[model samples]
Target: MSSQCPDADNANATPATEQWTSISKHVVNSYLEANNALLAAMGFSSTAEDAPTTESAVDTTTPSPTAEIAFGDENWVMERSTDDYDTLGVGDYVRFSKPIADTDVSAFARVSGDTNRLHLESDFAEDTQFGGQIAHGTLVAGTISAALARLPGVTVYLSQDLEFTGPVRIGETVTAECEIVEELGGDRYRLHTTVIGGDDETVIDGEAVVIINELPGK
Candidate 1:
């Protein structure tokens, strides 16, 4: 259940315990304040409050330590390609996957109050050429990142060249995969990507420039 008291304000200097009924519900900064005040009230008798902490506890770590993508080594960019040499070429693979669904889409519709038939009404899809409801194109593009995450050394994507070649029907599982097609100078690798449906037909096709960093800082 939500707290009965008014939401905390920036200007208010009230003690968090007095304003917020439960300690667990307090915001991070307010929780810290309440904790410190509670400790101060205890006269610092608790060893837990006085113990020294290690730097590693608060330090952030990379998502994948082993994943490495080779960016341009110095020579590739120096020699400006005048013809087909710019292509990323065959045998280069870019991987990607389906996006997980959640109740957020329902909440999003409720909050924004956008009751667009395509987004809210599955029945409306029956009348359309697509035959059934489909997610927004932008939403599908976000899933492309998840797919590329599976491949090694691909840290960041430069752009999404997404084309809705065919409708992505509801309940269908689609996967995005790519192949290296061209190379743009300065650590940018151009990948030709496609979103394939359960039937193995292309649903979306596009190109992306990915930055492959060599030797990411550990």
Candidate 2:
């Protein structure tokens, strides 16, 4: 009877353990799929075979077409005063605009380690003074960096000062306009940087000093 009992227990435990393992794999795969999708949206490719289907995924096997500027996607809008890197001077400006999607907030939260409830949880944010989820201030401010990247050269940030005057709601399209206001010489320039939200509100006001180096092989 003791031997029979051991056999019965082992038989039952085998199926149960197998079931648990399958469930664990499913959970891990789901998480990986979501993570891979987020990575793809942020201009990264996942080599995982079972990564989730995302329209943003780039084919790693193919060579990307060269562009005049290595920035932004089709959904992004860019307006620049000039493309001549050598001629970039005072009055040269670039405006880069894109919607702050939910995925962006999620990705930012994960990457930046800023899992603030106000930016991640809609239900929790609804009770806040802003009354809804808003994108991270630094995330919106990053648009200014994006705008600077579209400038006529390899732009390098020297320093930046930012003021968050307003909140940017999730899904709002914001435009970062960076205009060279002064030439500081030795490849350095001071720029007025401003981010305008969807409602035409200035969400972020800032100034940045940067050095624009010629693109490699230019």
Report the Cα lDDT for candidate 2: 0.79
Report clash pairs, candidate 1: 68-153, 69-153, 88-181, 88-182, 95-147, 96-147, 96-148, 97-147
Best by TM-score: 2
lDDT of 2 at 181: 99
Q: Kindly list the per-residue Cα lDDT of model 2 for residues 124-216, writing each as its tens digit.
A: 567679998899999999999999988988999999999899999988999999999999999999999999999998989989999999988
Backbone clash tally (model 1): 8
lDDT of each: 0.51, 0.79
Candidate 1 C-alpha lDDT tens digits along 28-114: 444455566555454342346445487655424333322232321231111111223233344566544443232323333334443
Q: Once superposed on the true structure, which residue ranges of model 1 sit more than 4 Å away at CA?
A: 1-90, 99-115
RMSD of 1: 15.0
